[model samples]
Target: MKEARPWLRPDRAASGGDIWKKMKTGAGGACGEDEMSGEKTILVAGTWDTKDDELSYLSDVIRGQGGQVLSMDVSVLGDPKLPTDVSKHEVAEAAGSSIQAAIDSGDENTAMQIMGAGSARLALDLWREGRIHGVIVLGGTMGTDLALDLCGALPLGVPKYVVSTVAFSPLLPPDRIPADVQMILWAGGLYGLNDICKASLSQAAGAVLGASRAVEAPTFMRPMIGMTSFGKTVLRYMVTLKPELERRGFDVAVFHATGMGGRAFESLAGDGAFAAVMDFAPQEVGNHLFGGLSAGEGRMTHAGRAGIPQMIAPGCYDLVDFVGWQGVPAPLRGRECHAHNRLLTSAMLAAEERRAVARSICEKLAGAAAPVAFFLPTAGCNEWDRAGGELHDAAGLSAFCEEMRSRSPVNVDVLELPCHINDVAFTDAVLARFDRWVAEGVISH
Candidate 1:
């Protein structure tokens, strides 16, 4: 049997505060004592066999800054000079495989897939056990690939910093990245540690540790309601709904319905974090289907899959958002357009497109495992689409409403209201159903 490492020795484990004491008085020079109440334990993970020096530098910097290190080796073949708290063999086994099996596959992608799966599972376990507060990972591409999965495994607000040679590259898509993760470019240190690379690594260490110390994790004391909307300029219902929901003994979290914001909303919903969902703004659904600025696939499906009661509305569903900086898409080039800003723009859909969007919306809602209420504000779906407004087209609105009322699944209760989406009457209708649901035990109080 191999001898245990010093950090994992039974004696050291029994000394509850030994890790913090040693971190404060470690060999490398200490920065001053942190005013924070407790020492943070940061998970330093990487392909340790190849980038041992870089990973060591990060660990040292974290320790020097009054933080404890939990080193995890994700290497496939070679061993690090120092023992890791979590070994490569252990990581492989976490994924129900072995290092030899990964090597025998004879493919770098295959080996890294095994490592990534193991790393994600171990990282999630560490977080759940309260053994780690933050994570800082280093890699060129393979390490970065594994880093995305590891970060995704943790809930939002846990500090996740990635130092990678391919940081911010096009190779990393919007869907692959977690909403709150921070990434720094690993310049000049691909092969070995240099001054340039050291600068990036040290900053990442301090940032993750500092964030861990400052972060206030969610308490989840109050049952939460998740809602989606654009800014008040377009969707004003949230302005009225947020305070009202709070008064009713529930916490409301309203997410911006842009690409990344919607992605974060879907992620939390997939985790079953919300007691119920008021997913009013589903423009990202049309965006994804039409090759516009998407919130990734499966935008409006998560809460339903989680079996949470849903109140759905077609807020801002008439327009599809795209990257304004890239010019309009070829298919939507000759349509009425509104430039929200330099980064985002919206184009009005034709009547046929509106019917298609209605069909798509009904199709997605058809899979609801729980009850669904679809509110069709017949006057308009958004401020700009109301009568006499800039993008208003009564014909288009009729097309969408007619298709929705005709084709919605039986599981959905299609309420055709005669008010604009931003009208007080519309808000009252939503509140009426919500209150009835709570009273009838369909929604939890």
Candidate 2:
């Protein structure tokens, strides 16, 4: 079995590495730009120690479909029986350790973790080198874990597909899954390849090939605007703001305030992906304040740390998000709430909780190196938080506005408008402030 093969065994008889292997040499586009290769040089990554036969079959299918296959052996157990272009030793080295260390540790889970991290780092390097056009993985569980790690490490635009028997299970956290990651159910793939496995495998092959062949959207030269909003029923500012930015030639990116979406937005901001942020919906801030899932750690801080021009609004600071699957937390039971859907339930926040949200936003913005604006629409922050609405609480809204005004940095402009969050006037105010920032040379015009 491949699991028992020697790690250093020479596939000396196999074709040379140049045709089937990829790694980072790192000459990039103009001024450190990262772009995908036009070639369909897909990486076929898997735990080859136990799944070499399956991986080899998949490679042949990829090659038959006109993809240049870069077979990566991520198995830490031992060598692979199949002819692999990228070996376990390479993956180990990328993780700042050796395969021998993983073997000597004698713990399967630990070894898998090391291999997974190493592979992910290596995948990024290869991607930067334009060596990886897409990624295809064939695994059940451990393989799927590594595949996800790799997918997460790669930039969002790259095409990634995983064929797993346990794909899309609750075992995987939703936040860890990139918005574009695709998975195929590996039915009848638990053991040897049956007709069922082959059918699934064929479909997976087609998907990666098709995605790699598709034309990549041209990137805009305009400054990117990172906009945040949630269910339109609640935070409608994004709807009104996106077009206005586009009309002025700024590329607008709207992130839903789901647990994963909020995390990704802040992450991209920190990575220098946006020129400015129009943080219109901050339900995620309330989520962090009131113990909810819609926000991950460090939601509002990244843009400030990136030193980009930004405008902050309490788009949905009145509510905290808790999915119906988890049921409301003990303290939140019987509180005013809205079930946006069976999967998403939002609990109304108290005045004190809204104050906490305001303080958190203030704390994140205190470190900003560029200009920042904090706006509160006095009429309401969201759809149901308005007068006569289900989640309306004038005191709660006032709490945020008052705290934000008092605690915001001296240089930060904290303003209030007598309008709802979704109102056109509110949108106009945010855009007008952005224009001032650009004109002041705070944000590039």
Put down candidate 1 lDDT per residue, 176-279, tens digits, no spaces.
78878999999898899889888998999999999998887554556678999998899999988989889998889999888888988877766556668899
Each candidate structure's TM-score, on Cα atoms with residue i matched to residue i, is: 0.90, 0.86
> Which candidate has the highest TM-score of all?
1
lDDT by residue for model 2 (1-445), tens = 0011011112222211111121112222111244434447888999888877788788888889888888889988667885688889999998889999999899977888888888887777776666777889888788888787888776656789999999978777665676578999999999877898999998898888778778363243466788888767667777777888888767789988877788778766665557788887767877876678755667888777666777888777777788787799987898888888889888888888788888888887888776788887899988887789888888888888888878887867888899987888987888788778767767663
Clashes of 2: 0
lDDT of 1: 0.84
**Candidate 1 Cα misplacement greater than 4 A, ranges:** 1-37
Local distance difference test values of all predictions, in order: 0.84, 0.75
CA shift of 425, model 2, Å = 2.2
